[model samples]
Target: MWEATLPSSRHYQIFGYPRVQTPPPLNKRRVCLRFACPSDLQSRLTMRRRASLRTLLAACLAVHVGCYVVERGDTRVNNHVLREQNLVLEERAENSVHSLIKVTESTSTTIPAPQCVLPPGMAEEIQGYQEVVDRVIDYVTTGDFKGQVYSHLANLVDTFGPRMTGTGELEAAIDWMVEQSIAENLDNVHTEDVQVPHWVRNNESAWMTLPRLKQLHIMGLGSSVGTPPQGITADVLVVKSFDELKKQGLKAAGKIVVFNPTWESYGVTVQYRSQGASEAAKVGAVAALVVSITPFSIASPHTGQQYYSVENKIPVASVTLEDAAMMERMQARGQNITVKLIMGAKNYPDTISRNTVAEILGTHQPKETVLVSGHLDSWDVTQGAMDDGGGMMMSWAALVVMRKLNIRPRRTVRAVLWTGEEQGLHGGIEYFKRHQHDHEQFQLIMESDSGTFTPQGISFSGTPEATCIMEEVLKLFHRINATQLTNPMTGGPDIAVWEKLGVPTGERHLARGLYYSYLTNLLHILNELFFYVFLALHY
Candidate 1:
């Protein structure tokens, strides 16, 4: 008796609630009672006028068995004879659907809608499940996951420092992650080789040679070319955006283009950093300088990769926000500003790296996998803590906690620590190329490379049916306030390959605080562990 109705946008269907059968017209006015608990009633309502009243009642009973409770004469509206109606709950034995009970009656119902519900189970059975979840949460929260994760992360940062792609540090860090996986008792720990580009940012510096003598803090953008030994000294042409630079036309020629775009959001402002160089070079600028990507900076220039035109390649670097603003102020006062820029940044040959992978075999279906992961590589400067270090350790801790709890899910849970993420998801791309044949076996691919501050919810990238299941699963963690689910889960870069293959993917949503204080903050690790435990017990 497997029957289910799905949202129209999706191509697949999930078996859960039974299909609704519309009652035959008692009279001319067929009062349509739309129930909103199942979240898929609208789609199922298309067949309402085809069935008899008795069949409709039977279908409702079978579909919503223990999840809902309907009272007799609940649908009496406009002089319609409403007899006994049963509130059927979508059974959790097959599909867990958590939805609000919203009854749209043509007239009105005297009974109030139910606020909360439990799936059909004996009191003892319900309590038993609750106790197990409670224990899992307690064990994970009380454990030293944060300390262990941070300590290991600190060691990686302190030992290997920057894991820029194609560097020895990145390779060493990958090896160390494998060793840590073994130490944590994770199964099948190994590294898969991935070739990545080598872009080095050697000695770099910027200074105001005119209008005021002051050395500006700067970090050469990755993959940028260097200037001559004498360096380029040119008058600074300040612009708020590429559009303004374009308007300058030939005026930008033989000048150092400096951009001071207002901070909006990372997605919006970071574009200037990514494309500022080529845009400047297109206008015949000798060199390009962009303000740091961070909205607020403490004299630290945030370094990132920038694309360059083959014929228009020129030196480009990131200047501190203060310096960029100072130059803009100087230009406003009609004062000429000249800067001396020198950089040894260069691109070398490609090098080989690896993605660290470990797995816990499933108790039931070992071939199917629930993939949890984060990138192991980072930018060349910062310790890469907040950017993704916290995310990496959080994933590692999930596997450790699952092992500690002696819980093996129905499918294998594989933890992949990716390399070359900062270098443009090269590691993830290679892995997908090698394993794309088995994409169907991937039940889910979860990435946490954003930041691990505090758990908010998960962003899902699958059908509404998957979202419904995730929403219901999250209810168990109401105590932690991490049950929220957003649609079109469009996941992170590492799993983008899998997402294109139609495999459902997701990423843990963390609070805004973690974005700033990522590695330094320890609160998010526990939240991540709680999320993982939930996946283990339920999904």
Candidate 2:
């Protein structure tokens, strides 16, 4: 007989199965089978069908269980990965927090000293001086004292617009300074003769004619030679620095070398202006050009001194930053750019110059000298108002304060307005050599050559203990925001000569940039306060 298989359960049933009723026999294991009717076969079939359904349900349950187990394992893996990521994040956060704490602690630990710790019985004098400083500041700012000093400064600027070294304007400026010094009741107001070399710029222009032709704004560098009347035109060779030029070798020969290097700071990047020409000339380049080193792009031409080699000298100039950038981009694109240079610059025989010196003799100790000074000359391009005019004013105002307060120092205060400082510090060298014999009498020398920004106390070139004492004395200026006192001073160019000769030197740290925009209005106030405080302390 054929059997039917159930698809759901994989079980078979006989086609003709009989239903049997069990009856007890003589023996316990005895059983009887009866032949089934049609109805009995049908009942057997129903019972078998029910059993198959049960088997199917059990198989499905096993499959569902397997799926659940697999899902649980996957979930565990995800959780483990999440935990690791969290731990890494937490570690980074902790490290950052620790770093911040260290920086904060370091900053807080550096403590600055207090200003003005005076002895007993000086309370009244200190109070009087403080009051005077306040009043003077107010008066000066309000334009209450428009004195001869202001007229003199204005007259000087008008008489000689831009007084470069070895120029006619420079000579006129010197005469004006000498006359003013004498008029101010200063003693020994005379000029120390000096010889200065003259460098003249005639005609200069530069442009790029490569991927695109564009006119460039440029200025012939100071002390550069003029090109032949027709000028020299050649392919441009760009160099990032001097070292790169050496590697290029003869490739840079017979080409106009361009130095496109950038400076991170003023102190470091100034070398290119001083030595770029000489370096380029060494590599057989016909001419050289430098991109402006300034941060701002005003399209203004910046001119500075260029060193020339004895064996090889060539014409050099500075171009606007915009022009340089254009050239750089074009060159990077493999475009061949050409530059035509025409510099009408020349150097003449050395001519006579002067260093103006004036003095206010001390009543107590006339022999002991305190030298105060500033450079008298400036570049020809800008007004040089901040570069040195401000310094000159401050020195003069300080002297006026000393005289008004009638507190004579133990040492004579001599003010020297040095000339030809920009030209290799020639005037300072000469003055030092002239006074080499009497250098022993110099008690202190101070120079304010840095721009007049704002007063920021002073830096002293003396023993640690002496500098500490000076710092303490400067404490009175703390209220005026002149707080910090630096050690191991980089004395000004004028005072450097004196320092080398064993004289103690110092330099006032003026706040740099924009701090002195309103200097004219604030001059009187500062002057009065300086005089009052210094006199009270000294007397």
TM-score of 1: 0.74
Candidate 1 — worst ten consecutive residues by lDDT sum?
75-84
Please state the error at residue 124 of candidate 1 in Å: 13
Q: After superposition, how far is residue 372 of candidate 1 from its true place, in Å?
A: 0.6
lDDT of 1 by residue, 262-347 (tens): 65345446678888988998889999999987657778787777776657798999998899999999999999999999998888
> Compared with the true structure, what per-residue lDDT tens digits does model 2 show for residues 380-419?
7644555566566556555654554444565677888777
Best by lDDT: 1
TM-score of each: 0.74, 0.70
RMSD of 1: 14.6
User: Which regions of candidate 1 deviate over 4 angstroms?
Assistant: 1-132, 144-146, 513-530, 533-539
